[model samples]
Target: MSKRTAILQTAAANTDAATEALDLALAMASMDQSVQLILASEAVNCISDNPSKRYAMLELLEAEPILVFTDEPLSNPHQLDIEIISSQQLAPQLNSYNEVLQFS
Candidate 1:
């Protein structure tokens, strides 16, 4: 079995890096590779603010998305299943993945 992957999206959703991260996750998921996304810092904006575009992108994908936040309640118009975690929990969580792709 292929190693599970955790993609770290640290850039704001408007940037190319964020888009690339999502693309990579989608591609990997389509190939049957286990994939997950880690949204840290500004990357959480992808779903927390003006989420329509981001929600559309995620609608067809099968990867689990995780959000790492500190002192900010998360809200979204979309119903995507998201795993929320604290910033302090990020280190150990990321360490649990066998592979990590970062778009920071």
Candidate 2:
């Protein structure tokens, strides 16, 4: 069975790390690896209205479902669409992955 991967994106919006994390996730997903893209803290900004082509390409790749760890969804000024997960869910969810790549 393919190993499950959790790509934890911790970079702030518009930063290179954020894009790199997405690119890495995309690459892994293309290889038929099970991938979960999780955005943490300010990295959540990378999801929406950001000036990154990768965000649009996210739909082209079957990498989801993307997840966000937060008590409540933010105002979402940037607007990358994904599920909002509670803190309690984060640990169990991350533990489910076979590997985790955190991009700070």
* Top-lDDT structure, candidate number: 2
| Over 4 Å off, model 2 | 48-51, 75-81
CA lDDT, every model vs. true structure: 0.76, 0.78
**Candidate 1 structure quality by residue, lDDT tens digits, 1-104:** 66999989899988999889888877887787788878888888777777535435444666565554545888866766677888788888888889988999
The window of 10 residues in a row where model 2 has the poorest summed lDDT is 48-57
Q: TM-score for candidate 1, please give it.
A: 0.85
lDDT of 2 by residue, 1-104 (tens): 77899999988977788878888888887787788889888886665434466664555677677788878546656455578898899999999989999999
Weakest 10 consecutive residues of candidate 1 by summed lDDT: 51-60
Quality of model 1 by C-alpha lDDT: 0.76
TM-score of each: 0.85, 0.83
lDDT of candidate model 2 versus the reference: 0.78
